[model samples]
Target chain A: MIDLELERFVYFADLFGIAIFSITGVLAARGKQIDLFGVMVLALATSLGGGTLRDLALNAHPLIWIADPLLLWAAIGAALLTFGYCRFWVLPRRALLVLDAAGLALFAIAGAEKAMALGFSPLIAVIMGISTGCAGGVIRDVLTGRIPGILQQDEFYATCALIGASFYVLLHGHLDANLLALSAMTLIFVIRLLAIYSGFRLPVFVVA
Target chain B: MIDLELERFVYFADLFGIAIFSITGVLAARGKQIDLFGVMVLALATSLGGGTLRDLALNAHPLIWIADPLLLWAAIGAALLTFGYCRFWVLPRRALLVLDAAGLALFAIAGAEKAMALGFSPLIAVIMGISTGCAGGVIRDVLTGRIPGILQQDEFYATCALIGASFYVLLHGHLDANLLALSAMTLIFVIRLLAIYSGFRLPVFVVA
Candidate 1:
């Protein structure tokens, strides 16, 4: 019973993540002067690109959206909603960041959990976690001809994901699966929020 | 016996295409100031990104590189050779362009053939063909913070690929497989060469 409840929570969180990322994707296309269809494509790319890449890398079949039409509908609907909302009011930057951190936490843990369920190695699980939470935004930025914030070594993006995924992988067999997922996600969300406020960055690697 | 020989021929052509793309990848990373490992990553991304993507989308297990170590070796070797050669002397621009056209032709047809063999529709096969022929370069360009030339409406890059793949799809049952692949590749290569020499431009779509 508890497992079922936690599973539903995770599923709902996943939907929220898709919506948040789609909103960010729609906003990212602001100066590009593309048509509505192009915006829709961009939004889908940003929300779904990460999971799609993860599924592909892992040979996870049917693709998430293809398997469940609701994911696609969520992404498209959120994109359209954001499009409409933005016409009247720009979303506050702080709110988006806070929501994004929550989304990232959910996405990272979900990716890690999926990989764990599939019997992948811990390292692979952690990497998938980072990619699932982060690759979409990278794709969105790169398509717009900008260096991605993650790759730019901007604060704690994939890094927080890495830690969250690692935490899940470490405690997975020891704790209840449902509780562990929430714990890991909470850890990531807290650290990411702290990173945002603290503004400390990891040392950037430069080629000599 | 004939089938085996043709299969071998295609396999060798795939290796050659990998080498060519790896060389181009090395050349593209000229000013990036990345280390040797970074160069190898770029080379692999350029050579394998498209096929890996196609396989995942189609639910093909065991990525091509994971299945055959030879492909990865080809990419690494070609990248190293290019890195050494460029340190001594630059490759002629004309030579690289001709080789790239040949490689593009092979990659596109190979992608289409794989999709067709899996029983996908002609349209899906064509899109896969374009992606296999072109996505690597886009990833490489995007990683380095440049909008890819393919996305820039540069030339008949994907256009030539689309025509070639369509040709193969249209005549698949009627023509011998080996002959069809070669013919389609030749058609793409010739038209790409023509596009380069004639400097014809596709109408760029711009929103008013």
Candidate 2:
């Protein structure tokens, strides 16, 4: 069935998303003087947290990473690579931003699809998508003793995910799979990239 | 109704649990040089994580602290107490160990009782109780960039909660309420204290 192909594609995207998040997590661990074990834990938490939370919230059985250990291995591999070659990697920060944008788009779409599979309402599905795409980074920051960037009302990080998730819900079954995926990814990537480059930010709701 | 009284007692136990956990969290953050906001967040996460997890797993609506801002204020009060007086109220680690034991016992009982009230099986209730009692500390450790003490094959932390949870479940509705509470609390406290004083620990399991 076409649905099977879609699922496979989404799973592949999920793996890439995991790798990106893991690499970012490893990078954050730099300058903090954490040992190798601490770095690995942060990497795992960053890569898997969003999906684990989504599964928990939806009461999905077996949790995604538990079911497919390949993602876990992939995250470990990515973290190891980052750790070993970070000094040689040119412009690590820029690379992280681009990969993070790709991950946000892919994860948001994947989360929305999963939510739809579970028969959640459109709004709830969208919310779940955003939560799934962003919660991992939030958990990573909190664990590393940083203010969760997502909660600080800065950065176009979660906003892009919300937009991509909405796009997925709108064009899920109406268009070709590649086109929809590309469009959603482009939407998130472009917005996030622009925000990073131009310093675009949303207004904070300061409590008086 | 008896159910009402039981609920009230569990609620108070949970509040006390939060206060105790917040104090520890605040103490943990003291030497780390985190800002005031970060300190409050660490305290809140340690105090509130277990209950939030319990509510989410049980599909309980309007999460406990979110429903009652009073609990939030109480945790803040506890955090402020730690920030203001931790240096002055220097107790021996053994004395603090006693406080930790009392907190662990009360939280395990409270968590199990709530799960039972939510109609989960006794097994599930006990698991929930242990998770609710210990997961906050796990979260705190992970966030502090350290391995969670419970995750390691170290002191009898979660095991004590697990034993107390099993005892409470076996005795549920059989004995009078006061006796049940006292026995469960005393069991966990005495066991944990003895373990600490006697240098008892579980063997490590390292997968080759």
DockQ for every model, please.
0.13, 0.06
Residue pairs clashing, model 2:
none
TM-score of chain B of each: 0.93, 0.92
Best by DockQ: 1
State the lDDT of candidate 1 residue by residue for A54-142, as single tens digits: 88788788777656668878998998887777767757777667877887898888787778778899999999999999988888887
Off by over 4 Å in 1: A1-48, A57-59, A64-137, A147-208, B1-6, B34-37
Candidate 2: deviation at residue B53, Å? Answer: 5.9
- What C-alpha lDDT do the candidate models reach, one value each? 0.80, 0.79
lDDT of 1 by residue, B1-208 (tens): 2466556656766788888888888877777898888888888898888788778787776877888899889999999998888899978877767877888898898888887887777766876787788777777887777766664445567778878999988998898888888899999999999989988656432322
> What is the DockQ (computed on Cα atoms) for candidate 2?
0.06
Per-residue lDDT of candidate 2, residues A131-172 (tens digit): 988998987787767888887755778988888888878887
What TM-score would chain A of each candidate receive against the reference chain A? 0.92, 0.92
> Model 1 lDDT vs. the true structure?
0.80
Per-prediction CA RMSD (Å): 6.9, 8.8
